[model samples]
Target: MLTMNDLKIDTVIVLDGEPFVVQTTQHVQMGRGGAILRTKLKNLISGNVLEKTFKSGDKIELAELSRTKANFLYKEGVNFHFMDNQSFEQFILSQDQIGEISNYVKDESDVEILNFKERPLAVNLPPKVDLKVTSAPPGVRGNTARGNVTKPAVLETGHTVQVPLFVEVGDLVRINTETGEYVERA
Candidate 1:
């Protein structure tokens, strides 16, 4: 069993037989008293979010979760496909579950898929990914009058990031998937 102290962002807990991932948590104490936890959680099954409060020292059960290595195959219609590395079995998830995570990955990328009770719950993206700029406007030459400047650039995966003005179309850039920010030129 886990307690309020074990709660943290991304922690999964079981409540009323439903699995919820903690989205946010704040701890507060009324002087000389026990603390309370305020948390925002998202249901892993139905994709709903709600705020929950827990008293200090409260015990909660942890959900049974699993992760497996998978390779993104491709998206067909509204479904995204993956193939397990060990079992070679295929899995498909809809856009609803995939959500904004689609922005961080492209075809053939390796990823970890989190599952609950044999169902895919979420996708864990890598820390960094290399992407090629598909469209980048030309930087004004002799426009060195400005300090560091960035221009919008679209990646091959269809995600856009602001790149240094010197970046050009076809340039390969590294991006931090977690932050969706440009890290450096690859």
Candidate 2:
């Protein structure tokens, strides 16, 4: 059990039998009223945002969440398959559950699966991933009239990212998964 004081960003708590990740927290107190804690929570399973308020004496239940190392095998239709590193068991998760993280995932990559009560709920991707550039348009001469020149390059994973004009096909580039931006040539 957690009290209002325990509420903080990224803390997972249970409300109405659902697990929610705390996104933001604010504390407010009136002249003669008790302290109130307000929070913006994001549902781990449904990708929903909710605003909730709790009094000073309110108790919050911390969610029992776990992370397991997994190797991404492949994607079949809308399902993404993964093999648990420790248990050697395979599981599948739908595209809707993966959200934008799916764009950064590649076959045979390692990821962490977030589990609640032994059930997989979401995937945690590394902050950076290295991918090969499959296609990039030629950089035209004198294109630097706009200060810095950039071109869209298609990666092996089929994700497009803006890269410097110097980047070309067959180049391995590091990308920031959280921002979906090109980091540098690996």
Candidate 3:
């Protein structure tokens, strides 16, 4: 249990049976009353933002969050599937939960999954991932009139990213997962 005074940014807590990550916290003292804490929280699974205020001494359950290594299995319609490496347990997450990680993850790749109370909530990807270029358009020479020198290339995961004109099909590249940008050839 955690009291209002313990609330801080990045703290994970359970309210009304839902897990939330604290985005911001402020201790405000009303001129004539005890201090109150105003907090901005983000739903870890649903990606919702909520504003909540906790009066002094209010207590909340600290969420039980865990991360496990899982290998990407496949995607069906709106759901993505993974298998735990250790336990070999299978799990599914909707597209909403997969979110941006879909851009960098590929079939059979190992990723980290965040579980809330032992249930899968979200997928956490590394800062960089190596992917083989599936297709890249031939670079046109002397076409710098518009000053755009990069061309779109498709990766093994089917994610499209811009690569320098020199990059071509079959090249393995390291990409920044967060920004979906090309980092360098791996």
Candidate 4:
């Protein structure tokens, strides 16, 4: 059990028998009445979001979650496939559940799968990943007039990211998965 004060971003709580991860939280204070907590929660099972509010002194139930190593196999249609490292069991997560993380993942990469009640709910990627630039337009001169000079480059994973003008095709670049931005050459 946890109090309203314990609610914060990334906190997992059980509500209506479903596990939800807190995406955002805010504290509100009334002039003379009690305080309250406002939160946006994402459902771990269905990938749905809900906004909820709780008053001060409210008790909440925390959800138990686990993580396991898995290998990303490939994507078939709208589903992303993975194989458990230990058990060799294969599973798939839809694009909806994967959200934007799909843009950062590479084939045959290792990742952590979040599990609840033995069910895989989501994928966790490393903060940074090295991917080869499969395609990039030639950098032209005189583009430096702008404060920042960058061009869109297509990665091996089929994701496009802005890179410095010096970047070219066949170059291995490090990307920040969280921000989907180019970090540096690998």
Q: What is the TM-score of each candidate against the true structure?
A: 0.89, 0.89, 0.82, 0.95
lDDT of each residue in 1-186, candidate 3, tens digit only: 999988889899998899998999988999999899999998887889999999987888999889999999998887899999999999899888778889788899999998987899988899999999999999998766789989999999888999998889999999998888999999
Model 1, residue pairs in steric clash: none
What does candidate 1's lDDT look like per residue over 15-51, in tens digits?
A: 8888899999999886988899999999987889999
User: Which candidate should be chosen as best, given lDDT against the real structure?
Assistant: 4
Listed per model in order, the count of residue pairs whose N, CA or C atoms clash below 3 Å is 0, 0, 0, 0
Note each model's CA RMSD in angstroms: 2.1, 1.8, 2.7, 1.2
Candidate 4 clashing pairs, residues 3+ apart or interchain: none
Please report the TM-score between candidate 1 and the true structure. Answer: 0.89
Residue 154 of candidate 2: its Cα lDDT? 96
For each candidate, the alpha-carbon lDDT, in order, equals 0.88, 0.92, 0.91, 0.93
Which numbered prediction scores highest in TM-score against the true structure? 4
- Which digits, one per residue and each the tens of the lDDT, describe model 4 over residues 70-119? 99999998999999999999999999888888998889999999888899
Weakest 10 consecutive residues of candidate 3 by summed lDDT = 140-149
Name the lDDT value of residue 141 in candidate 2.
Answer: 70
Give the Å shift of residue 142 in candidate 3. Answer: 1.9
